[model samples]
Target: MATNILVTGASGFVGKNLSTFLQNKECKTNALSLRNENWKADFLKSVDAIIHLAGKAHDISNVSDSDEYYKINRDLTIELFNGFLNSDIKKFFYFSSVKAVADSVEGILTEDEVANPVTHYGKSKIEAERYILSQNLPEGKKVYIIRPCMIHGPGNKGNLNLLYKIVEKGLPWPLASFHNQRSFLGIDNLNYLIYEMLIKNDLQSGVYNFADDKALSTNELISTVNKALGKKAKLWKVSKGLIEKTAGLGDKLKLPLNSERLKKLTESYVVSNQKIKSALGIEKLPLSAEEGLIKTIKSFKKEK
Candidate 1:
């Protein structure tokens, strides 16, 4: 039987892919926007599940206001969730980032860790998560708060795009000395998890962390991109002090290799997907981290 699904942020990278995937699975899908005034009356009664993906993303430029993050991410979510509670919706899937838990992960981040978001964007998401968890969900109603780390795929151009451009330009990776590992969620695997949550009757209402099974280093990521592009990798192991000084200068010159960018490039943010995998009764995701990244790199080449 085809399930009727309402997806917010349907035009976004994740939502666009998710909506298409749902339609391919023979599920009827509709998009709802927060800009509409009568969303509650219009969508609440019509869908079997609501996938809320619309929120103020973490702005890399740091230009967006703090209040704006709270208003859109936290306040809007509360309003929509309250409406969902009052309606006949069976499931609600909230797309929260792992940043909501920690700006920097010490080891493998799990659902059990105490959330201490650093940035305003992260704080706003945690606020929304708190609100959702605080609510007394009625019987037969399921709500999930998903925290995904560094989602990548064909249509999405995030930090991966910057890396892709650098690799395409044949620029030598200068920060090869910063040894670190980071987790990334492939859009295919993320789509698979969301679909599972939609169809599975056993997924309990709780927070789940989503990620690819394996964590990769920045060096490995560059190598993967090189392989995808059929180009030889050019990694330059510049001294840490020299790189730091250059990044300091770059910060003033508004260059790409700033302090923040360097941290993101080299930081080890290994998220644990064990809980979600166990809940879904799967040991591995459909796509590996490198495979998904390769697909994304291929898309970048196609664009050029």
Candidate 2:
């Protein structure tokens, strides 16, 4: 018997990949897009589990209305979970962002750390998480809230695309000398973790941070991109001071690479995946840092 899986945000990067992957694994998958009318009623059918991935993404430019984030993200979560309270589903998966826990973190990020999200996007997710945790689940019901760092895969359009653009242009890579360790979640790793979450009934019901097995640096990431492109990596040895100054100038000049992006380019933030690994009783997660990165870069090259 095929397990019935219902997924929201079916058209998104992670949701689209997850729905396709579930179907490929012989699960009866039904996807719901946010644009569809009366989606909740359409979603209340014979679903064995529900994966909630719909929400307003972090509007980096801060142009969206204040109420929009809460209404769509926080309010929608409350509405959906309330609906689930009446449904027959036994398992629920919510895709939250690491940003929900912290906008800027020091040292290795852990699940035990106190959450203090700085942006509207993160705050809204945190609100949703609190709502779900406050409710008592019916017997045999399990809920897993996943907070993953910057996720990148074959079709991702986030920060990964920026790197691809810089590398794809065959321009002299200006960030070669920059070094910073950051955690990333590959689409494959996320799929595998969700599968484990469904299978491991004994796993605790709480927030779980998902990420790749290894922490990788930005310079290292560029190397992988370069390898995939089959070109000699052109890393410039620009001094950090000069780069910072240039970025400062960019702040006023409205240049493409500004001070904020430079911080993202050279910041040390590593998310620990030990919790999920222990919960799944797995020795190692499937995708290594380099392998997943190279695959993502190669995918972009093929897309061009």
Candidate 3:
């Protein structure tokens, strides 16, 4: 018999990729959009597992209402978890973000650290996680709260796409001097982990931080993008002091290179996936950081 899996927020990027991945694995997959009032009826059907990807994404534009995050990310998760508990689903996967623990990780982010989220988006996610943890699990049922950092893939149009465009345009990367390492989660690796958890029943159910085995600096990212473009990388090692002052001025003058955007582009946010690796009894994930990144960059070029 095929494993029946129900996915929420099936229209989103992660949901779409996961659904396809599961289908390729020969699982019976069903998509349940929260927009439909009859979603609960669908969720209550015969499902072996549930992957909850429906949530309000962090708004970098700063235009979204604070309540919206709580409503969708927190409240919706509570409703769905309650449904999972009551249903016959044996495994439940909740897609959370690294931002739920900290906006700026000083060092490598691990699952043991205390969560001190600043933004409403992070607050809502942590709240949902707390609620899920507080619940009692029945025998033979498992729950996994996965915190992935900056997930990127072929069809993704996030900050990575911005960098790819700049590199494709032959624009010189000016923040090469910032020298910060950040972690990234490839969609393929994420799908592999989820599939492993679904098939392997002995793995313990708890919070797990998901990231690539290696961390790459933004300068390295620029070079990788250039490599994918078959062009020589033009990385300008401008003085960090001058860049900071310019970003400060941009903050006041409403320029494109503001402090917030600059930090996002160059700050260090290394996440440790050792816990998950240990759980899976693997030294490394199937995809390396550069390999995954190059694949994503190549996909961007094909869209041109």
Candidate 4:
């Protein structure tokens, strides 16, 4: 019999992709929205797995109410996990962000790192994780908390989209001089890992971080985008000192590049995926970091 899967945030980019992938694998899938009134009902009793992808992301604009993150990311998650515990579901998957572990990673982030979330969004996610860990599960029940860094693909929107616009316009990238290594997870690889987790019954239940095998610098990313667009890479070697000053002034002058934005652009955030790879018994992800990124860039170009 095909496995029955219940997915929250089914309308999201990840959810849409995952649901389609699951269906293609001959699994029965259902998408539940946050507004669904029957979320806690016995409707989930028959589900083989529940994948929770619904949550309020960190408001990059810094305009959303702080309470919103906790209510959805923490409160709703606890309620759903409780339902899972009560139901017959054998596996529960929660999509957490690396930001929940650390807003900044000094070195390669491991599963052993002490979580010190800096933002309310991160705090909320960690809160949900703690609740799940605190509960006792039946012998056969398993829970997987996945922390992915900067997930990007054709339909997703994030920092990658911003970079794509710059490269698409043939504009010179200014912060290429920062030379920082950052980890990214491709949608394709993430989809494959989740599918494996669902099918592989012997895997341990715990927190796992996911990322591409190799970390890429901003310079390399710009080059990749340029390559996808069939344009010469134009990276200006701007002074870090001047960039910092300009960003500082942007804090009060209502400029586009603020201190926070600059930090995100230049900061090094390399995450290690060794733990997840080891668990999945895989040596490499399905797609190279470069190949997945180029695929996303080409989609953006096609959208133009």
Best by TM-score: 3
Q: For candidate 1, report its TM-score.
A: 0.96
Question: How much lDDT does each candidate structure score?
Answer: 0.91, 0.84, 0.91, 0.89
Ranking, TM-score, top scorer first: 3, 4, 1, 2
Ranking by lDDT: 3, 1, 4, 2
lDDT (tens digit, per residue) of candidate 2 on 1-304:
2278888898889888888888777777788666666877776567888889999998888898878889988998888888787888888888888899998778899999899999889999999999999999998778889999988899775788877787788877777677778898889998888877766668778889999988888877777788888877778879988999999999999998789988978888899999988888997888887888888888887877
RMSD of each: 1.5, 1.8, 1.3, 1.4
Worst 10 residues of 1 by lDDT: 38-47
Q: Assess every candidate by TM-score.
A: 0.96, 0.94, 0.97, 0.96
Q: Which clashing pairs does model 2 show?
A: none
Model 4 TM-score, all chains together: 0.96
lDDT of 3 by residue, 113-144 (tens): 89999999999999999999999999988999
Give the number of the best model, judged by lDDT.
3
User: Higher lDDT: candidate 1 or 3?
Assistant: 3
The superposed Cα distance between candidate 4 and the true structure at residue 235, in angstroms, equals 1.4
Per-residue error at 257 for model 1, in Å? 2.8
